[model samples]
Target: MSPELYITAGAALAAVVVVILLFKAVWRVAEPNEALIISGLGARRRGGDVDSLGFKIITGKGAAVMPGFQAARRLRLDTRAANLQVSCVTQQGIPVHIRGVVIYKVGDDFASIANAARRFLDQQDFMTSAIHELFTGHLRSIIGNLTIEDLILNRERLTSETRASAADEMSKLGLVVDSLQIQEIDDETGYIVNLGKPHAARVAATARIAQAQRDQEATEAEQVAAANMAAARRDARIKEAAYQAEIDRAQATSRQAGPLSEATARQEVVVQETRAAELEAQLAEQRLQSQVRKPADAKAYETRTLSQAERDARIAQAEGEAQATRTRGLADADAARALGLAQAEASQAKGLAQAQAISARAQALKDNQEAVIAQQLAERWPEIVEAGAKAFGGVDHMVVLNGAQGVEEMLAKALTLGGAGLGLARVLLNGNTPNDSNSENGLKATESRE
Candidate 1:
């Protein structure tokens, strides 16, 4: 490159740099936190209808400003805080000192910027002092309208009252209050402090009561757990004792196992020996039954048979003798009966003859009963003798107690019986005794003769 061309290029580059710098100086930008106020030049005339200040406002953008004909001023739209302290009285006439902070910013609208630019553009750093003075008067007025209780507890009401009291005046300044906070209050009479004493005491008492109740419940739970632990320990000890007893019993039983086994073996041997002895005894009994018992039973049976046969034969002989005695007695009885019947007939015939003779004699000599009875006796003499002989008809032999004279006296007695029948015949013939009596007298006389 040529030297002249190099100088021309350098000159052109310097001119471009100067133009860029001039453009930068003339083109002012408004940040989001600030507004640019342009006055002088025809730029003010562009927004004079809206703001009536002949100033143009730009915010959050850039505008071309002529260097000398127009001027740009930055009005900060960022938030600012002002501290306020005021001595005031509440609606209840309680004197208090209030300390607060008010947060505010310049309005971002063009008219607000124009209004702010006309008033505070040259003294931006003095904004807090002006806001602090303005809000102090407003806060005093706000506190005067509200009670101490409302100021203490009602933040919304405090804010609303602040806005109501300061809104129009701050609008004239093109400022908006973002917040007005009452940071602290000093009660000269201790009224506000006294107001919270009862609630604080009640909250303290309630907290203490809750803590005591929790402590009591925890103590009771701990005591119950201790009791349960003791009971569990006692039960565990009892169970352990029972298990130990069982273990001891098992060990004792194990220790006695040898003796028990030996006793059982001995018992088994004894039982076997007893069974063998019993078998031998049974075999001996069977042998005795087959040998000695059979022969003894046969001998006893033969002797018993012979004794029974002999006894039976003797019984038969005695029975035969008794039968013969009975037959002989029967034969003698029959013969005696026949002879007695003959004697009775003979006596009856003799009595009848005597009765007929006495009856004939009584008829012949009606007053001579003795004579007639005597004649009946004489006529029945032979029948009397025959009836006396018939009395000995069944006797095979006779023994006279005396000599032949006894025979003569027996004949006389027999003849006297015939005379007794004479008395019966006399009674029959006379018709003084009954016939039955006469027959009875006749039977008596015949029995006497026998």
Candidate 2:
């Protein structure tokens, strides 16, 4: 082991290390985020046909090739985001500024990876900008079929239209869109605001109506609660008053019990005393009736008997006087009848005598010269005086207040009355004529002769 031998060994070891490092350095790796594109000489491909692409694309693995003979390129397979700002007219001819984001990824298939490798392998940093310009024209066509409200509210329709417009164009670029978002919408003519105006106002009015209804219900509930509270208070007061009245009645009954019992006992005692006094008084009255009233009645009956006997004696005396008066009256009547019979006999004789004289005069007047006789009444003066005296003789008293001369004068006048009658007869006889002097008397005379 000399120093020259150690130096040669060290050179060989360094050369082997350099060759391994060079081999490792020339080998290209395809990461999970990218695809590796290899070209220029002896690149192993899967297909035998030469008309197929000559280059090879590999993803998610590593490969070894000579560094000078092979060239390798990388294309990103991971998701990429692009900010899209497009100013274009829609198919409906409305101009709009659409700001959006597109999320895309390179295709994993061999053909799609090969196409992406050729186009964007050297400019991977500028992938987003390229996808933005490509999507601008496609977005215009998509928006043409949509309205402002459909873009804002109907996201599903917006996405469907975007896919229909941009799907084919994006396929050519070897990228698939995971999502497209219209981040901001600018409506130059207030189309979006006016579109939402009716619904916004309706929502605002409905909110106010619901709030007012709730407030009114709350107020009514408050009033009902207050009324219930007042009713409860009134019931409580009524119950308290009823209980107080019951307590007062009970106290009054308790206070009166002793006095009421005493009064009842006193009344019963007074009734018993009154009954005893009535019995005693009845016994006394019965004794007095038998002793005093019976004897007094006997004495009164004896006095009445004596007075009745004395009255009977007086009645007999008065009856005897009445019998004597009746006997005297019968005797006076018998005497008076006898006198009336004598007067009747005298008057009959006088009337017979006067009738005889009148018949004789009438015969004389017819048979003789029918002359009337003149008479002297001096002889008949005594008769005329007797007749005049008899007229006043039946009077019991001659009451002459002119004294003794009046009585004598009355007797003389009675006697002289017959003389006065004689004077009138004398004058009557002076005018008398015989009945035969008349001419009609001749007819009476001739009838008398027959």
Candidate 3:
């Protein structure tokens, strides 16, 4: 066993059988969403397909396929979906029931993946019921030209009427309808909630007529503010009854004036006691005519002058005794002178009958000179009213100083005291008595024996 150690163990057993036949003639592997379509006999050309179906599409890469001339297949590009249930007829021929969905893929341009791998490769589970019986006869000729409001609000005219009715039978099965969706539409009558109900009842009757005209203008402004508060309470009760009657007429004129000035001061004290009793009855009638008629007219003028001097001495002693007794001496002196002339004619007839009764009482006082001056003014009318009462006898409190010229100067000093008692009765009728001789005096004693 030596020829150099059997040539080094026969070259290590021929390099371990050429590494086990080069790992069984070239190894390979690829996966992850697949693409391993190795064709028969030496497949290789990728990308832009070249010739015969002798191919190679090892996606994520792996190779070593020689087993009996090499061949393999697995082509699934991924995205796909199709659910379409349709029963249709429209164009006013009604009869419709449809529900749809169709999203497709497996055509990233490998010539639309070799035309969907020659029509679904091998009936890929009936490819969604053969695309829902070829889209239910193309959705009944696209709802026969459209009506149901152009299939509910015209979605771009229902996708241009579904691409003008399935674009020539999906281009004879090349297929590219990426989406054709219409989830539901099943109407037999009740049109669409009676189209909208009349415009919502005209917007609810215009909001109830604007709320009844704002409640009648708030009740006529609250009754005109209660009639202006009852006319201001009747003008404040007529100005408080005219200020209480002007305070009761100024308290009744101040109570009459105080009893009219005390009745004019008691009528001036009874007119000063009736003028002092008329001056005491004119001083007692002038003291009874000055002590009883001037002493009885001086004793009747001394007893008539001693009775006419004793009758003239008895006629001179009887004529001297009749001539002394006549002795024949001339017939006795003629009878004594006829008896002394008959006694001197009887004493001159008694002194002419007493001087004719005093000249017939002075011719009846000068023929009744106003009845002797009204009987001497009625016996000296109380001494001419007491010299007119001495001019109010110095009036004690008389204030009649000048009102009416002091009562007309006290009535002209009481008529000048009756003209001084008629000038003292004309000086006692012009003389008389005083100391008579034989005039038999007194009542004027024969005017002093003139």
Name the candidate that leads on TM-score. 1
Mark the regions of model 1 whose C-alpha exceeds 4 Å error after superposition.
Answer: 45-51, 236-259, 271-450
- Deviation from native of the Cα of residue 383 in model 2, angstroms: 99
User: What TM-score goes with each of the models?
Assistant: 0.60, 0.49, 0.21
Residue-level lDDT of model 2, residues 242-301, one tens digit each, is: 999999999998899899889999999999977865665565555544653355345445
Best by lDDT: 1
User: How high is the lDDT of residue 179 in model 3?
Assistant: 75
Candidate lDDT (C-alpha), each:
0.77, 0.69, 0.59
Q: Give the TM-score of candidate 2.
A: 0.49
Can you tell me which runs of candidate 2 are displaced by over 4 Å?
Answer: 1-16, 48-51, 90-94, 149-155, 224-450
Candidate 3's residue-wise lDDT over 1-450, tens digit each? Answer: 679989888899999999778766655564655456666776857547534444666667787777678766666766567787777766777666778787754544445545555677666566667767777777777777777767766645665576557666555454567777787777666443344345555555555555555555555555555555555555555555555555555555456546645655665566665655445445444553454334434443444455456666766655554454333234456766764565455445545666666666566655654555545654455456566777679878655545444444555567456766554664564343233213534423433342
lDDT by residue for model 1 (1-450), tens: 899999999999999999999999889988889888788878754434564577777878999999889988888888998888889999999999988888998886766666677789999878789888887888788778889889888967877877888889888888888988888988989998899999889998998999999999999999999999999999999999999999999999999999999999999999998797667557656665565446546655665676679889978966885675455446666676775576566556756766676556545656777775665554444556567667758889655566444545554565456566766776676674355456557756765775
Instruction: Please give the ranking of all candidate structures by TM-score, highest first, separated by commas.
Output: 1, 2, 3
